[model samples]
Target: MDAFYASVEQLDHPEWRGKPLVVGGNEARGVVAAASYEARKFGIHSAMSSALAAKKCPHLIFARPRFERYKEISLQIRDIFYEYTDLVEPLSLDEAFLDVTENKVGLKSAILIARQIRAKIKEKTGLNASAGVSYNKFLAKTASDLNKPNGQAVILPEEAEAFLEKLPIGKFFGIGKVTAEKMQKLGIHNGKDLKEYSLQFLTKKFGKSGLHYYNIVRGIHLSEVQPHRVRKSLSAENTFEKDLISLQEMEAHFYPIFEEVVRRIEKSGIKGRTVTVKIKFSDFSQQTRSKTLEQYPNADQLWEVGLELLRQEEIPKPVRLLGLGISNLNLTEEQVYFGEQLKIPFHISNGKG
Candidate 1:
């Protein structure tokens, strides 16, 4: 599912196809949730400010997000996955890790399974999919992006070492922009550079994450594909067109977001004991406050807690965004939460899938 939300918009509205399109946001405010490849030519991308996106491409067309449609397509794709193997670990609405080692159809080549899956997806949904075939999740996830829109690539186990050596540190799955910069300042620039540091040295420098970095660069990720992973948390947030100036104003905006959270909680039939509120100031600073209770709180109580957190502090500047979420879920720890950005395939897992 390449450029998923934007692609869906293009699919349902034929005239929009092959043209610059975006989902969510407006020229005046909000953020680009997804951008079509045509839009990408102008350097528009997800999380970029809408004002900047419009500045980049004055002709850019913005569509309000239709999450229900995206979820419908995602479920259709997942049904196709279940046909191949029950060992499907969905990383997001558009991408998943499929352990097809002993698939229902008995296909030995993970590459073929990946292709057939992509073909079925295209056939059924009228949208394209890409796949990355490899022995483990890290390389497979990495390889999935090598080709764009309706393409697939593979990485044999033997080639992973050489491939990783040349990979940029910033491209590593678990590492982020700030951490990658920190690594660069330490004279670590790529997988090869990262491999030079000892585990003890890395742990001392990065705490628990040091071990993760040390192993991933060496192609040693041990986490298995968790097919039954539960969602860890659910949250909703919105950026303002204009800065909100008062506590009364903040509470007014806050209720709808909390309503969304409740809507989802009821839809999923999942409950959590924690309520968290997030505030982003106009200056680009952010804060989050959480309250954990003995049981799941009702809407009124959650709203009360949300308002309490919003008023607990006096702001130095007006707010640009408001958010609310819940955690301490009843589900087990084996879980993967949906992300703003994510991917992958695999008839392969590190083990027998």
Candidate 2:
């Protein structure tokens, strides 16, 4: 899918097509959940403050996010994936990795499979889709973004090494801005530079993740497309329009987030022992505190642990955002106990794991 949320908005509302439209946010508050290509041209993007987005493009149109609609379309797309391969691993509503090594259609060429998939998507959903055909997940995920807005790219095994050698380290999949900056300080600006470091040196510098970086640069990724990937955590967060000055005010806002996390955990029929509180200050710096129980907690226990974590925070500055999360999940098929139904608003639901 290309510019998924914004694209869906355009698909349903033809008048907005080809215009500079954003899916989530307002000029005064909130953040951009998705941006159209027209909006992107003006430097607007997902996670950008709506205020800044409006300043960049004064005429930009904003639409409230429609998550339920997006999920409906996502299911439709997943059904399409099932037509070709059962080994489809969805990374998000907009993206997935498919192992067509043994597909239902008996298609042998991955490139053709990609093209066919994109065509089918356009035909069924009236949306353009981009794809990347490669020998492994890392390369496929990386290549998927090379061409944008309804395009496809392929990296054959023969071309993988040389192509990666010329690729910038920052462009590598899973490498964040901070890590890229650290790599640059160590004179590793490209794949070729990264390949020169010893596995021992990388492990010392990066811990367990060093092996991943080392293998990926050499085009040696071996991970498979896992269709039933288990979620490790459930969380909900809110960014305030204005900074909160008191702990009382912060707690007032955090209650819903705390409840939302518990609601999701129970809804999934899964239990987790650890509850974490995440706090972001006015300066954009952040901190997290967590508590773990020997046994799965009920609603009251979860709330108490979360509240304790938040109350323990030494107020260093005005708070900009607060979040609550649960992790250390137990994946067994057991009924999780969450005392009773919450009193949250019927329309106010947002939790992601």
Candidate 3:
């Protein structure tokens, strides 16, 4: 899907077509959740402050995010993918990875599967989707973005090495601003330059991720596209409009986000033992503190534990962003602890001795 939220808004409200539409908060302290391509031409982008976007393009029409509608459409699109293959991994409401290598439709080519999937999506949902077909996950992901607004690109296995060699390091998976800057410092501006560094050296510098970087440069990724990627944790982090120095003021900001997380947990039927608090200073330095409970916690328990962790933080510097997360899940029937607790006698293994 292209400009998913905004596109949906435009489709439902025909008046917004071809005009710059933004889906986000229109208030004083709101951020852009998604921006239409027309808005993009004005240097407006998603995740940007709504205030800043307004400054960039005063005529930008802002609409509040409709997550429920997006989820409904996502389900419809997912069903279409299932018709072709069961190997569908959703990245978000609009983007997904489908492994059509051995499709249920008995399609010999992934490109044909992509085309059929796109056609079904447009017919069912009245939205356009772009697709990428490649031998590996990384290449396929890159190819998908090569064309947009109902486009398709394919990277054959024979062309993988040459294709990657000429690509910039910034275009590589997981290479964000921080990593790109680090690579540039080491004279690695592109894949060809990155190939100069040995796996041992990269691993020594970047720990476990260095090995992945080395393989990525050589077009040698073997990661599987798993559909059942269980979410270990759920969190919400926000960057403030103004830096917060006082703990009282910070807690006030966190109160709503805390409530939202609890609401999400209750709605999703998720429970976990760990509560983590993440803090970022004005200088861009970050720190995290967490507590593990002996038993899983509900909504009230989450607030009690989360607030305790927040109170323990001694603000070394003005805070820029704060996040709260729950993890260390135990969702099994035994772990749910509905039955009575039992004590069993232990028996030694005499046969082994």
Highest-scoring model, TM-score:
1
- In candidate 1, which residue pairs clash? none
Q: Sort by TM-score, best first: what order?
A: 1, 2, 3
Q: What residue runs in model 1 are displaced by over 4 Å at the alpha carbon?
A: 332-353
Model 3, range 1-353, lDDT digits (tens) per residue? 88998999988888888998788656344568898999999998887877788788877787756667887888899899999888877778888888888889897989988999899999999999999899888889888888886899999888888888888888887788799999889989988898888999999988999999999878888988887676677776766767789999899988877877776677667778999998888766889989999998878888888889988857889887788888887554322111111111122232110
- lDDT tens digits by residue: candidate 1, 254-322: 777888888877877768888888989977788999899887888888888888877887876899888
Q: Give residue 350's lDDT in candidate 2 (0 to 100).
A: 30
Off by over 4 Å in 2: 333-353
State each model's CA lDDT, in order: 0.84, 0.84, 0.80
Give the lDDT of residue 231 in candidate 2: 70
lDDT of residue 148 for candidate 3: 84
Q: Estimate each model's TM-score.
A: 0.91, 0.90, 0.85
What TM-score does model 2 achieve against the real structure?
0.90
